[model samples]
Target: MPQAAKRSNDVPGTAPNLVHPAVVNDDAVRTALAQHMSRISGSRTEITSFGRKSSGFSWITYAFAARSALGGDRKLILRVGPPSGLFAPYSVLPQVHALQALAGSGVPVPALVSSAQDGAEIGFPFFICEHIEGDVPAPWAASELDPNHKRVIARQFIEILASLHRINPDATPFASQAQGADRAELRAITGWRASLARPTARYYPLLDWGGRWLEDHCPLPPCRTVVHGDFRIGNFIEHKGRIVAILDWELTHLGDPHEDLAWAMMPTFNARSRKLYGVLERAEVIELYQRASGIAVSDRSLAFYEAYALYQAAAIQMCAVRAFEVDRFNDMRLAVMASQMPSIVRAFERALEAAA
Candidate 1:
C-alpha cells in the first residue's frame, strides 16, 4: 500500500513542528484510531504511517496506512469536521450515508470503511475510507489547457452530475431529509440569510437586495433530485485526463438539480475565461445536461438558480468572515476569505444587474 508522505518534522525521532489545532495531539489520534479499528475489525490494528493532509475547508483529512490481522494492510483517509470549521456543528452521517448510496451506483466515490458521529472514538466525528489515487486540478490556473482535454473532463463532469440527480431520494438516506423543491430553495435561502443576520457577519448591502430578488423570483422545480451543494470545478479529482472522483459532499442534500448546475457555472470557477467553468459554453452546458439528465431545463429556471447561487456564495463568505473575526479561528484561510468580501459583493452586484 502507498503511504501518505510525511513531512520531515512529522517523522519519528525529529522535533515535530506545530500542527493545526484540528490535528494536534497526533500521537493520541493515532492511538485512538488504532483502538477503534481493532474493535470494529475484531483484530489488533496498527497505524503504521500517519500524515495530516490539507484539503477542504470544512473537513480535516489525514492519510494513513493501517495494518490489521484480519484486514491486512491498507491505505485510507480519515475525515473529521472540526468545531472551528467554516460550517460548524456538522454531522458525518449525511456525508457517509450519501457516499454509501452512491458507491457502485455509477458515481465514483471512496469506499466507506467505517464511520462514527461523535468524538468519543476519534476525538471528533469522523469516517474512514479507502485512499484513492488522483490529482486535484485547481480552478484558478491561467495556463491554457488543451481543448480536447477540457471536453473529455467536461463530459465526465456533466454525466456524473446527471447520474447523481437521477438517484431516487426516497430510496437513499436523504429520504428523511427530502422536501418539495420549492421548500428546499426557501430553506437554503433562509439558512444563508440567518448566517448573514449573525452579529459577527459582515454587512453587504447588495446581499440584501439579492436576497429580496431571490424570494421574489423563486422558480418552481421540475423535480427534486439529490443536489451536490458545492459541485464545482475545484471539487473533483482529475487523473489521466478524466475525473476519477467527485469530492467534498459536505453540502449534499435533497434539492433542485439546477442548483448544483448553477453553482458549477459560477463565474469565479470560470477562471475569467468567459466560459462555464472555463470549459463548456452556456448553451453547450444546458444541452449536455438536459440530454444526459433526461430532464428539460428552462432558461428562466436556470437564471433564477444562477442568481440564487450568487446570493448563497456571498452568504458563505460572510460566514467565513465571522469565523475569522468573531470565532477567532487560527486558520489564515478564513482571514483571506474576509479580504475577498469586496470582490464577492461586486460579483453579486453584477449578477443582480444582469438578472434585472
Candidate 2:
C-alpha cells in the first residue's frame, strides 16, 4: 500500500512525506479515517494506499486500504464534498440512502461502507465505498471495442436503466421526491435558471428564450423513476466489455425516466457518432429501453425532455463558468467545462427548434 512521504521537519516516526500532489494532507486524512473507522471496528484503524486520485469534476477522492486487528482489511474509495464543488451545497444523504434502497434493484453501484454529512467528521460530507475494479473508456475516444462488444455494452446500458426504473420507489428515499409532474418541470427549469440568473451570468439571449419555451411547453412526465440525473457513457465503469457499475450519483433524483434517456443523448455524449452515446441510434435506443422496462414512450414526451436535457446541460456548464469566473477552483477542468457553453447553447437551440 502507498503511503505519504515524510517531510524533513516531521516527527521522527510518522509516515513518509506525501509528494503525490494531494489536494488534502495525507496525515490529516489518515487521522480522520482512523477516528471514523474506529467506531465500526472497535479498535484503532490503519489507513494505507492513501493516494490522491482525480476522476470527476465534482468531488475530491482518495483511494486507500484499511485494516484493524478486529476488522479485516479492505480496499475502499473516499469521496469528499468540497464547499465550492461543481455542484455546491452538497449532501450525501440522498445518494447514500438511494444506493441503500437499490441494493437489489440491479443497478450496479459501489457498496456503501459508511457516510456522514457533518463537516467536523471529514472536512466535508464524505462517504466510503468498495473500490470497484473496472475501467471507463473515454466516450469521445475512438473505438477499441469491436462492433459486437459495442452492441452488447449499449444493450447493458439501457437494460440497467430499465431495471432502475422498475425498482419500487414507495419504500425508498425517493418516495416523496416530487410535487406534480408540472411542478417538477417548473422546479427543474427554475433551479437551472438560478445558476445563471446572476448579474455576472454570461448570458446569451437564446438561453433565456429556450428556458421560457421549455416552461411554456412543459409536458407531463411519462412516468417517474429514480432518475440517474447524469446518466451517460463516461459515468459508468466497464469490466470485460460489460458495464460493471454506474459510478456517479451526485445528481440522482426522482423525476421522469425520459430525463435519463434524453440526457444520455446529449451532444457531449453523442458527438462521436450519429447514435446516442455512440452505441445505438435514437429510435433503437428508445426501442430497447421501452422493451426492457415495459413502458410505452411517447415521441412528444421525448422531444420535451430532449430540450429540457439540453437546457439543464447549458445551466450545468454555467456552474463551471461561475466557479471559474470567481476562481472558486483552480482546476483547468472548470475552464474547459465553461468553454463548452457556446456549442452547448447552439445544440440546445437546435434541439428546441427541432421540437417546435
Candidate 3:
C-alpha cells in the first residue's frame, strides 16, 4: 500500500500551485499522457498538472489545456486516485464505462476521454476526460439563479435521472464488471449499517431505526436502472440555464432509481433554500421525473429512501471525519468535508422527522 500524505486544512477556493508547467516532471507519465491525448485529439499535448490537486473529494484532479493538432484548444480534467487508495470499491474505469454506456441515452455527462487502471503511470489509477465549462453556483445560488432557470435546471436534473434509471446495465459493455442487483434496498441498508459500525462521536439511533424500517418496508420493485450515487446540484454543471454535465460517478451503481431521487431530494444538499430541496420544490422535481420517466413517484417509497439517504450520508461523513482524525487525510477537501457532518446530521434529523 502506498503511504498516505499528511492532511492540510487549506482553505477552500485557494487554487494550489497546479498551473506551473514543471509540476508534471515524471518523464514516463508525461510521455504516456501526451501520447494518450494525441491519440484522442490528434494534438501535441502538454500535461501541466500531474501531481497538483484540483477538485472533488480526496482525489487529485489535474486540469490541462489540450491544443489539438487540427486547431482549437480544449480543457480536460483528469482524476487520479489518491496514493493511499480510495475508500470506495468503484474505480475510475468503471465510471468511464458508465459514462460511455450512457452516451446517446439522452443523459448529459462529461465526455470520457480515456481511462486506465494501471498504477505505474501516475502511482495510482487515473482517468482523463473533457471538462464541462460552467460555474457550479455556490450554495447561495440556490436562491440566486433566475427562478425560471432554477426551474428548468431542476426539471432537467430530475428528467435526466429518469433516463439514467432506464439504462439496462446488462446491455452495457460494463455488464460483466458492474455488479448486477435488484437489491437496491438491501444493499443500501447493509452498506450503511457496515459504515455506521465505524467509530463516531455519537451513534445515531435514527439511522439504525431508518435502516430497519427500510428493510421491513422495501418498496415495490421498479425497473432496474443506473443510480448516480451522489446525485445532487453540486455534482452537476449548469450551463446556459440547463444542466450540461452530470459530474462524479464514483458512487454510481445500478439499483433503485429512487435512491438517486431521494439523495437529490435530501435536505442536506438543499444548500439553505428551504423552498426547494436543492433549489427546486420537492413536488416540482418529483413531478418532472414522473413526467419524463413515466413512472409514478410513490410517497411511501420516497419517504423511505429519503431517510435512507440521510442515514447513509451521515455514516459516510463520520467515516470521512474518522479518516481525518486518524491523520490519513491526504486531500484537504475530504478533511473539511468531514467537518460539515454536524450540519449534515442536523439536516438528516429534520428530513427524518418530516418523513415521519
On TM-score, the leading prediction is 1
**Deviation of model 1 at 288, angstroms:** 0.8
User: Candidate 3: worst 10 consecutive residues by lDDT?
Assistant: 16-25
Which residues of candidate 2, in runs, are more than 4 Å off? Answer: 1-26, 177-182
lDDT per residue for candidate 3 within 1-356, as digits (tens), equals: 12344445556888333221112234555566677777666667665544443443455667676665575676778777654443633367657777888876788888887787774445457887788888765555576557777767777778788888767767875556545544655876787778777665556676677666667777765666677888887778877787788887876666677788887876557765544534576777778788888778778778767777877877777766665555354556556766677776676677667666
The C-alpha lDDT values of all candidates are 0.78, 0.76, 0.68
What does the lDDT read for residue 296 in candidate 2?
Answer: 80
Tens digit per residue, CA lDDT, model 1, 1-356 = 11111223456877655434344356777889999888888999999999788745677889999999888999999887765566767799877987898999867888899998876678788999988888776777724677678778877998899989888878888877665334767877878877888876467777876787787777777988888888888788888987878888877888778899988888787686656657688888888989999989877777778878878878887776676676555567667888888877887787666666
| Decoy 3 TM-score against native | 0.79
Candidate 1 structure, TM-score to reference? 0.88
Report the C-alpha lDDT of model 2 over 1-356, residue by residue, as the tens digit: 11122133446778544333234555787788878887767887888568767745577788898888887788989888765456655898777876788776689988899998885557778888888888876677736666677788888999999998877767678666655434555787987777668544477889888888888888776666788888888888899887988977877777778888888877577555768656688889989999999878888878888888888878877876666665335566667876678888887888898778
- Native-referenced Cα lDDT, model 2: 0.76
Better of 1 and 2 by lDDT: 1
Q: Report RMSD for candidate 3.
A: 7.1
Candidate ranking under TM-score, highest first, comes to 1, 2, 3
